[model samples]
Target: MRLFIAEKPSLGRAIADVLPKPLRKADGYIVAANGDTVSWCIGHLLEQVEPEVYDPAFKKWSHEHLPIIPDRWQLVAKRKTSKQLAVLRKLVKQADQLIHAGDPDREGQLLVDEVINFLGVSKEKTAAVQRCLISDLNAKAVKQAVSKLRSNQEFIPLSTSALARSRADWLYGINLTRAYTLQGQKAGYNGVLSVGRVQTPVLGLVVRRDQAIESFISQPFYEVWAQLETLPEDGPVERFQAKWQPSKQCQPYLDEAGRNSSKPLAENVIKRISHQPATVMQLARQHKKQAAPLPFNLSALQIEASKAFGLSAQQVLDVCQGLYERHKLITYPRSDCRYLPKDHFTEAKLVVAAITFNSGASKAATSLFGTNSEAFKSVDIGVKSRAWNDAKVNAHHAIIPTQKKLNAAKLTSTLSAIEEKVYRLICRNYLAQFLPAYEFFDVKAEISIGTGIFLAKAKEPIKVGWKCLFPSAKPKAEADNTDQESEQKIPNLHIQQGLKSLAARLDEKHTSPPKHYTDASLLAAMTGISAHVSDSELKKVLRDTDGLGTDATRAGIIELLFKRGYLRRQGKTIFSTKTGRAFVDALPDVATHPDLTALWESRLTAIHDGLSSYQELMMPLQTQLKSMVVDSRSVVPHGLRGLGSKAQYRKKQYRKKRPRKSKSSAKV
Candidate 1:
């Protein structure tokens, strides 16, 4: 009997659907007539035992048990899924051969490998153990993957690395949490302070942002603008706007950071340029091209969804998962890669055909590219594009529409509003890849008056190209804050043409503090932390390390902060609580710094690449944990100070409620 194990029930059903049937369904598994069995784990059937399970003494929080390290790790069946585990155990014991059909990632490899180990399916028990790696759940992809099964041993390094990560998190979380909670309890606090490898650093990011915002002082600044006009030979008089720039000799007042600072200087410049004749000293027009935006990786998708639909990061992930798992309309939703494999270009035609077959999408495509035109035909099939590059492809390709034909009516009827929004984004991005580049002309003009030079600029779109798909998308100038002049059309003018200023005005503006982090911006910061670091080597390391968390795990880490009351949301902005700020301030730098996470990720990568063994990777972490615990002993605990104050408030209330016995007792 052949046993096929999958990561989730949906995946198990997908695998079964591809097999030659007359399949008989069991309580928790399916059996083909040919004595083959298919079953699944609801994520993981077994999880690592808690610290208390190791030793009864470890059950209670105490500093004496600091740095609790297990000698031999243990796994216990998760209570909620114990029945599924029993089904899997019976099937594993009865099978003659086994096929591991899990997600093609480190966590996925460990999910099934751990189950097999828990079931005691040793090498001698099964005739052969094979691995199946399929990214898409469609029948064709599943069958094709089954035909090319490899040995499970090939992925042992990944499994080991994943196991090391789990244990490392446990060691840090359990030990640090106990040490801190015990310290807080001694200070008369009554709250548990939870900490973790990923959650702490993520919380640190929020705390630091809030600190910057609170300390920022707004400063008022001034700018001078002139509206000018030039009479053309035949057409209407052309008018445009320009800004004043004072020369160095004028001794223009500037802030310490070199920002323009003087209201007097701005007023003087406006007075000097008002109603004065100005010559266009320089007028340059440069044509430029912008490539289509890259396809959605999970992080990018989450950011866009947050900005466009006002959905939280977790909500976007849930909707994307539905699109991938339930509708089977997209590939994996947890991918970190934004580029497709070079060979996937061959499949692009099928995806395009699927999109063009849908009534709404077909109309949009026709309206933009013109039905029966060469441009439309090329994009509807396949074209060479920057999005297809093998070197940039990682564990999985970018989230894209699968070749499975979508039922347009079914999609609108079945999908929720947010799911439909995300699905349309995925489809539009995929269609954009085959379209021509967005072409535009960049226009800049410099006008001189006295010692000061004023400038104007504009961007004129020459071809809508891929941009037509997102008609409501903001222009680059507006999105990037390039220049206010870019929003208007630049009138035609000779290099030395003389123009008269119609009006000059001074505008008062204050330097605004940094905006609080929205889910969109925070996700960008988490994924692109390299831009924030100064060390060249560390920046490179962070870029290669995949940032703070995996796409699959980042949402959960952010959600964890909210659940623990370490972070709060005000409208779309996130802020750290007083308790959260105290927690971050009290912890050692090693515990809250993002670089520490990056370093660990680098070592994990080494393990996955066969450069280091899991033991070698873990030795340093274990040492770090021991050192951290020892260092934490000397550090003062201040995170739960609020709890102590609350206790005092409650005590005062109790005293007030007591009977007035003090006066009677004194009289007696």
Candidate 2:
């Protein structure tokens, strides 16, 4: 009998749907009439055993048990999923051939592989097992994937990378958490001070940002603008604004950013330029083109969703999962790559149609797509943008809408408000690829009033092609339309052309401190962190890699920080708690910076690419854990002052559940 093991029930059902008909649903496995069986693991049926399982002595948290390294790692069935594991064990023994179906990512690879190893399948059957990688749950995609199965041994390196990462996190988190909590107890703060590989660095970012904002000192700066009028060859004279530039002679009186510090110097420039004859010394004008925005990976989607709808990172990932698995509206949602395979370019027409047909015009009419969805119809479906580069596509393509024919009537009933919004966002980017490039003319003028130079910039629109699709710019993107240059319309002028200078406009401004970390910016910082490293090559590698953790895990790490009282949210802004700041201050530098996380991420990627081994990654991490464990005991920890004063306040992470009304209350 052929057997299929999927990552989850939904995926199992999806696989079973495409199999031969006359299927019988067993307790935990599906039996096809053709003697094929399909079963699933609930997330992970087997998990790493806790430290206590290694030895009874390790059950109690003690400094002596610091750096608790198990001689051999072991896996046991989770209590909640023990039944599922039993089902798999029975099915695995009966099957003649096996197919491993897991999500096409690192975690997915490891979860299914570990299950097979734990099931004690024979070496011959394991070596010959077929691997099924499914990124989309639609019947057509799944059927196509099943037809082209590969040997599971090909992905052993990927599984090894994940195994190394899991064990490394365990060694670091379990050891350091025990060590630090002990120190905190001695400091009068009786809270369990958890330290994680990813969570601590993220908390450090917030705490350090808060500190910088507190210490910043605002300084007054001065600027001079020339209200110059153009002398056109014909028609009415047009006026435009230009700003004065600091000359090399004014270096002493100007700040490093070239903002004038002397009020008297600014007054002189204002007097000199007002009503003076100005000559256009330099003129530059050329058309520029901007391509459509790329489709989102998980991180990009989370960041944009946070900025647009104030949704938390975890909220966005949850909604994405619903859209992918439940509704089948999108492809994979946990992908880190933003580029699409060149082969997928052919499906543009159908994807656009699916989104347009499923507009949910009546009940779910959105401001983005509206009832008509006319924007998609006009998308010239042949214009393949740079987003279709095959070289950049990795693991999975960008998160995208599937070619599944969506039912408009059922969409409103099946999807929530946020799910609909996120679905439309994915569709919009996919449709944008078929639109033309945004073309504009960048016009600049360099005006001179004696020795002082003034400059003006304006952009003239040539074609509002792709820009029509996006009315407003997403935060921190290249499409920010809020700038003055994009709005300004420059009049006709030539070099050496004479112009009349109007009254000068001078405005004083103060340098402001950096803004607090919001949910959006913090997530952005995690995936694309500016690693503070001196090695040029390693720094570039870190910047290129997924920053602190995988896209699938970053949201969880942020959520963990909040649940542990290490971070708090006020409106959209995130701040480190007093306990959080104090904890960071007490720890060693390596424990609080992105450098360590960056190094680990690069090494893991090397393992995935077949350049490194599991030992290469874990050996150093194990050594580092030993050193940190020693420091935890050797160094004197200063407790969080006044932390236990109202210990209950920090302990109240979750609200109590309200009791249901009694029968008497219901009668009333």
Candidate 3:
């Protein structure tokens, strides 16, 4: 009997539907009349246990028992999926051949291997272990995957990488969590303080941004603007405005004795303008142009959705997952590539045709350039870029609309605005790729006003180009930045039309501080391209590394921050909790610095590319982690030293406020 194992049950059923001959489906297994059988594990059927699970003595919370490292960790069935696990164990025991249909990545490999090991299946006795790679969980993908399974041995390196990563996380999570939790309890804290290889550094980012905000002090400044009107022969003066001399850049316009004015800049600019007529000094003009956005991938989608609709990373992920697994409308949802495979253009066209009739995509489809057009062929593929490597592409190409087709009417009216925006973005980019390059006319006119030079500019789209894909996608806010202006083109105007100033008004503005970290912005920052570090070589290394975590894992990492009460997002900005800030304060800056994680990532990539040994790359981190355990164990406050008196007072007030309940209200 051939037993098929998939990443999730949905995928298993998808495969079952495509198998040849008579297919019989069961609660836990599926059988084909030709005798091919399929079953699945729910994501992960087993996982490593905590240190406490190995020794009861390790269960006690005490600083003395810090760094509770386990020897020989055990793997047990995930509690909620025990029944499904039992069924899989039975099927694997009796099967002659096995097909691993889980995801085509490291974690997926581990999931299948762990199960096989648990079932005591000897590799030598098994007929074969085939790998099934399906990107979009659709009938066609599943059918195609079954016909082309590769031998399991071919995936050893990938699985090894996954195991190494998982084990490293386990070692850190288990050791540091126990170490910190025990220390916190010793210091009279009620909640467990947890840490992870990724979480600590992520929290560091939030805390640092908040400190910058709190420490910032606003400074007042002044400015002046003069308004003027011009004759119609000069084209209505184009609303002339003026800039002050060098003295205006500073606060030198004080009354007698250089005393600065207490009045606001708006009042001052108006007063200065009312005193005299403005004069023309000089005119300057320059031309500018912009290009269309590249394409959509999982990270870009999440970033855009969060900006456009205020959706959390996980929420966008869930929606995309559903779109892939249930609706079969798109491909994989965890990739970072923003470019399509060169050969996938044919498939891209079919997918576009599928959505154009139902959704607002038809208008975009009509404006699309032909697939064979030179305009579509100019995009740089960067053949040497890792992001574009064919070998790195697994089950699916990047997250793209599938040729399986789309029916916009089938989409629910209740679909989130974010979902609509992201889907449309995909369609627009795909369609734009085939369209003529968007052309624009830029007009620049310069006019001098009273010893100052000024410039004016505008852009006019000469060709709608790919922009016709989603005419409605013009500028939206907070999470999305799509609009006619965002597309690069030239403004309509000639340099020699003569000029005229219709009107001019002085405007006053304050220099604003850096904007707070929105989810989208925070995601970008965590990638660790820091300028503070003195080592240019290290900075370059960090730039080449993956930021924070992989796309497949980043949502979970952010969710972890929420779960641990380390961070929370209000609207779009992410704020660190008091506990989170305190945790950051407790850890060494360099230890939790984003640079370290970036360095680690760079080395890991080097290991993968054969530029460095895995042992050399990992040994330093392992050593650092051990030193961290020792240092943290000795130094963290024993009784909540960092939380300050507010927490204590809150606890006191809460205890004092505990009121007696009415007898009838007491259920016990």
TM-score sort, best first: 2, 1, 3
Poorest stretch of ten by lDDT in candidate 1: 659-668
TM-score comparison, 1 vs 3, better candidate: 1
lDDT of each: 0.76, 0.82, 0.61
Which lDDT tens digits does candidate 1 get at residues 84-141? 9889989988888899988777788888988887676776653368888777887876
lDDT of 2 at 21: 93
TM-score of 2: 0.92
Question: What are the C-alpha RMSDs, in order, of all predicted structures?
Answer: 9.4, 7.2, 9.7
lDDT of 2 by residue, 1-668 (tens): 99999999999999898889999999999988888889999998766666766676776789988789877787767667888988998999999999999888899998998888877778899999999978888998888878889999989888888898888888888889889877877877766677889888888889999999999999988878888887655467998878888988999998877789888999999988899889999999998998989999999999988987899999999999999999888998999888998877877778877877787464444466433556656788778899999988756789999988767777766789899888877877887888889899999999999788998888888987776657664444454222654467777888998888999988787888989998889888887765444357767676465578899999999998887788899999998888899999988889998888778988888888788888888889889998989988865457584473445334222113222221110000
lDDT of 3 by residue, 561-625 (tens): 87767788787788888878877777667656767766765665554444565466556766777
Candidate 1 TM-score, true structure as reference: 0.86
Itemize residue pairs with steric clashes in candidate 2.
none
